[model samples]
Target: MPHVTFIEHNGTAHTVEAVIGKSLMEAAVDNSVPGIDADCGGACACATCHVFVAPEWEAKTGTRNEAEVAMLNFAAEVKPNSRLSCQIEITAAHDGLVVHMPDGQH
Candidate 1:
């Protein structure tokens, strides 16, 4: 498992270990981390699982795919680091990954 940190727009942080191969959205939802609504249940159809990948961890998380970038247009406060959490897979290299939830998501 890789440890992930979810920080709410208001600055609350929840850290948990995510099962290998699981989506980042699943880890956040499983741990009851605030701000990740995940209304589409890990599907790329929804932008409710929006997150801001910390700058330091950006390279490890990878860029958004075509579908993900298209869906992000529907999300509020989209930023350069915005990503659909469901599209991110956990790996050992992401052990210290940190993400920030947008104010809209909260």
Candidate 2:
């Protein structure tokens, strides 16, 4: 399992043990991390799972897919590191991964 830290817009941090092969959104939802609504249930159909990938972990998280790119258009405060957590599968390499949530979901 990988341990990921989700930092809220206000600086609160929730660190959860994420199961490999599961999506980041699932990890957040499973641990009840605030700010990650995961409204589409990891279907890549909504931006409620939006997160900002830590710069050092960006390469490990990989590039967003076309569907994720499209869905993120609906997210608030999109930035260079913005990503739909549902699109990122967990792996051992992602241990210590840290992500930030926006002030609110769109």
For model 1, the run of ten residues with the poorest summed lDDT: 97-106
Cα lDDT of model 1 by residue, 1-106, tens digit: 7899999999989999898899999999998987889998987998999999999999999999999999998887999999999999998899989999999752
Write down the RMSD of all candidates, one decimal each.
Answer: 1.2, 0.7
State how far residue 14 of model 1 sits from its true place (Å): 0.5
What global local distance difference test value does model 2 have?
0.92
lDDT per model, in order?
0.91, 0.92
Model 1 misplacement above 4 A:
none
Largest lDDT belongs to which candidate? 2
The TM-score obtained by model 2 is 0.97
Give the TM-score (vs. native) of candidate 1: 0.96
Q: Score every model by TM-score.
A: 0.96, 0.97
Pull out the clashing pairs in model 2. Answer: none
Q: What would the per-residue lDDT of candidate 2 be over residues 49-86, giving only the tens digit for each residue?
A: 99999999999999989998888877768898999998
